[model samples]
Target chain A: MITTSIESVPGRKIVEQYGIVQGSTVRAKNVGVDCVAGCQNTFGGELKGYSQLLEESRAEALDRMIQQAEQKGANAVINVRFGTSTITQGASEILAYGTAVLVQ
Target chain B: MENLIGLIFTVGLIVVAYFVGKTIENRHFEALKAREREFLDLPSLTTQHSYDEEGIQDCRLVYGNVVISGDYFKMVLAALLKFFGGRIVGYESLIDRARREAILRMQAEARQFGADAVINTRFEMSKLDAMTQNQGTGMFEILVYGTAIKVNHG
Candidate 1:
């Protein structure tokens, strides 16, 4: 399949549209990691743990967005954008969206 | 005297252990990044065909999914841990990376087919299910598919 970004992929023809194709997962922390993280802050150089966390979430959200487009029989997605929100203090949600289209 | 000595030793031990563990984790993360870079750097293979004499070409390409399952699991765990503290994880990077890689592959395929643009792209994901009694393993699939077209530059 061909995939194109909203800005890079040209043409206005949309063959199919999928309404809010979304995928989400919720997570909770283990006490062990937290206790350790708290201690590391004093001498911290980099928060590698948190960096890895965000990377994973972003991939999951994008995977869901692509799944949605495929289900709609779309050849490509255009004008893709992402949004994130905190469900609580440490918990967050990532969302990806785009317009499903077919170019003639 | 003994209590003071023990407390200091315990704190020192915890601090040391924390750094060691973090270093190991960081090393693994770096390895993952390297793998991702290698995957993206591989040349994209494309195929194209033309329909009608108007110089319009139709193209299709396949892209392999980079399933970072280990990283994903870690991030989820981290987010859960942070929930109590009210800090959220930034997930945009992962999504953006996946999208970018997929698009690049598509474009490469279009170019291979001698097409100027790609049209009608679709993505899909499949998860594997295992039957406990039968001992059958299932496979998860993620796919990005699209058509490429060549048009007049003017």
Candidate 2:
């Protein structure tokens, strides 16, 4: 399936509208990673552990959204957006939402 | 005696953090500049859609994100500046670095996917401070995403 952040795919025409589809996931890293991130924080640099965790969670959220679009019989998802929120010291929530539509 | 020891420890921590943080920030900025030069020709735009539909062969979503934290010295400096109600240069640079790094990563992903350009790019920046409550280590997460498109050469 085609996915884009723009309102419409570049060369495709929207033939059907399936409304909005969304997916969200709350994820956390292990204590070991969190400990390393805490040390990195004190030194003021990239928190590589946290960055990886967030990226994995975001991909999972996107996959879920794609599955939803597939269930809706849509060929593409457009105007995608992402939202993030920290839930606790080691966990975060990532949400992906977009409009699902059929294209030709 | 106890108060003197505590004061020395605090001062020493700030001194070390200041120098170390400066070095890291400088190195990061240099790296960003070098990588940006490498992707100078790959356009990353905020436009909602690809302008030339006929020239594009395929497209897919690509994204990059990063989590960065302020050093102890920056937190201390920002705290002091908060009292005076003026600009906080420390935090400003932190955000700037995170923003550029995120974009660079996105562009790198597009390159890996063999895409000519990225369109409809969007940025998301948020504070991860709640997770580090009372630690005074300001944390931020920056995410950038876009549609990477492969253009027809012929």
Candidate 3:
């Protein structure tokens, strides 16, 4: 599926707009990462574990957005956006939303 | 004796962190530079929505997201600089790394579609690990998305 942030897609014409489709997930830090991160904070540098967690969570959210678009019979999702929020001290939510459209 | 031992342990850990973190950062930067050079031909942009709106042939939405964690040393430096109330170069590098990396990733995705350029590119950056308000323990995530388009080469 082709998607773009611009209102219009290049080459193909947007035949129909399916409004907005979205997906979101809330993730908590793993215990192992928490323990290691707490200790690593004293030495400060890249925490690989947390980076991995964030990446996975983000991909999950994006996947859901695509799935919703698919269900809506959209060939593409445009103007995709990612949002984040700290729901609690231990968990954070990742949200991906976009416009679904059928392109021809 | 116990206090001395604790001091040694703390210092040793920070020193280890300094070297380890520096190595990782340097390596990531090196990779970023090399890839950026490879993408010199594909120009990504923020304006000029349709790639030749008149003769546009095909377009697709492509995106990339990256999350990078600040090293302990940078965090510690930021904490120290907080008292001086000045620019924190240490944290700046963290932001720069995430930003550049995210853009590079988006470019890579464009390349997959054989796109000559990406249009209307946008970025979203946030702290993924900002559990503690005043603490230096936080992770930065940068998400970049754009439309990859190929226009006829006239």
Best model number under DockQ: 2
Error of 2 at A4 (Å): 0.3
lDDT of 2 at B69: 93
Give every candidate's TM-score on chain A: 0.70, 0.94, 0.92
Total clashing pairs in model 2 = 0
Q: TM-score of chain A for candidate 2?
A: 0.94
**Highest TM-score model number:** 2
**Sort by lDDT, top down from the best:** 2, 3, 1
Candidate 3 ranges with C-alpha deviation above 4 Å: A32-49, B48-50, B130-136
iRMSD, per candidate, in listed order: 13.7, 1.8, 3.4
Binned by DockQ into CAPRI classes (incorrect, acceptable, medium, high), candidate 1 is incorrect
lDDT of 3 by residue, B9-48 (tens): 8677667777887786788789889989999998789885
lDDT of 2 by residue, A1-104 (tens): 89988888887789999999999999866788778877787779899988898899899999999999999999899989999887887567899999999999
- Which lDDT value does model 3 have at B81? 93
lDDT of 1 by residue, A1-104 (tens): 34543232443445555554555554433456445434443333223444345446666776777787788777666555545554654455656666666554
State the weakest 10-residue window (summed lDDT) of model 1 chain A: A39-48
lDDT per model vs. reference? 0.46, 0.89, 0.77
TM-score of 3: 0.83
Q: Tens digit of lDDT per residue, candidate 1, span B46-139?
A: 3222223255433333333422212323344456767786433322333434445445554555566676555445565433112011111111
Better of 1 and 3 by DockQ: 3
Using lDDT as the measure, which candidate wins?
Answer: 2
